[model samples]
Target: MGEWIQSIADTYKAICAGEAPWVALGNFMNAWYDYAKDQREALVSESLPALATSSLEQRRWAAFCVASVEYLCQRYGLHCPDWVYQSQYSLVEPWFHAVNPHKPQVRARLIETTPEPFTRRNIYCGNKMFANKYEFAAQAGTTSPNQAI
Candidate 1:
């Protein structure tokens, strides 16, 4: 896990240093995929800064990073802290769905700092859903049950 994170961090450094497109993107995506396979939640959270920095007109890659994080959070029962999600919206909005609706913080500074009226809801609730899903799975004793995660 440490090695994987180091590779990702190195990729971020390369991107910051203006590395070539293929090397930077390939390294980032490779590291991200490995982390996802390992179900490393903290690394997933930690990767956000690098991902935000590494998003260089590669909108699809940016979206990939976001979706990967969301999926891992769901898989591993890791809820992003609210403040962290708050920070990321300044970079880009995460993925969305019908059940989750945007919520704008009413604090004066929050409103002043962000002109956008809303941020994605459930930004931190994915892990709770994951845990519930796990518990349900445990109860069912099989993976085929009809349930939401």
Candidate 2:
């Protein structure tokens, strides 16, 4: 992999390791989006779906990428429809959808700040849908993982 890709990979690893994850996650996502913009259809349609049946490691990496996008949306005031983060909103959807790549689908007014709202964000619990660093910072100006609580 190129140094740029490798750096993003490292950020993903650091995030899994719980080391400066918020910053690393942001960096990794920025790089991923940049690359995605270049690759366009092939990356979103072919590359991402290829991971669906890939080996465990590759699949995990794919999941990490999806999660990173969700994280960026939540943290950066980018809006996503509540459903976008859910499993139903597969990685392949963007290729077919004409929406702005950087912005979320749902308007900002509808995005709940709570970690686990009354409405389930996904088919599985928290497979996605959680606050970003800014959301965490707003609450007592501290970061606390809410799902566990």
Candidate 3:
């Protein structure tokens, strides 16, 4: 397998092995940014459905897997695979991507701010939850006074 594919597989394995969903998602997003455009398209159209389906069968982190894939697809303007739209991928209850001591107010705010892609899957997180370093750099551009010569 290609390195990008392997990296994504490793991230998925980590998620299945009990890594925190948000942390695994960060790792996944970083690896995703490294994928070439064709690879990214293939990943979304071919590979992600298997991973999401496996997570669903495992009955652990299924919502996170589906929502993360859909979120990435939406961000990049890719076509989300049909399996992601199945009823099984949607969580029966809302899952707030928060740590212990999850505050009710925080959950409320997340519910308010989470993007449609995630909210539809019943996965709630900050609107910027998927932002990565590459996105930050792109947004920063070269105009910052602090940029090195």
Q: What TM-score does each of the candidates earn? A: 0.33, 0.29, 0.71
Per-candidate RMSD vs. true structure?
10.8, 13.0, 4.5
lDDT of 3 by residue, 3-32 (tens): 545333455566777787568766656557
Candidate models: Cα lDDT each = 0.42, 0.39, 0.64
Q: How far off is residue 20 in model 2, in Å?
A: 18
Which regions of candidate 1 are displaced past 4 Å? 4-11, 47-68, 71-78, 81-84, 91-149
Misplaced by over 4 Å in model 2 are: 1-47, 81-149
| Clash pairs detected, candidate 3 | none
Task: Give the per-residue lDDT of model 1 (tens digit) for 43-75.
Answer: 544553444444434433333334434554555
Candidate 3 Cα misplacement greater than 4 A, ranges: 4-10, 35-38, 47-60, 100-102, 142-149
Better of 2 and 3 by TM-score: 3
lDDT tens digits, residue span 32-77, model 2? 4554434322222222233233544343444545544445456544
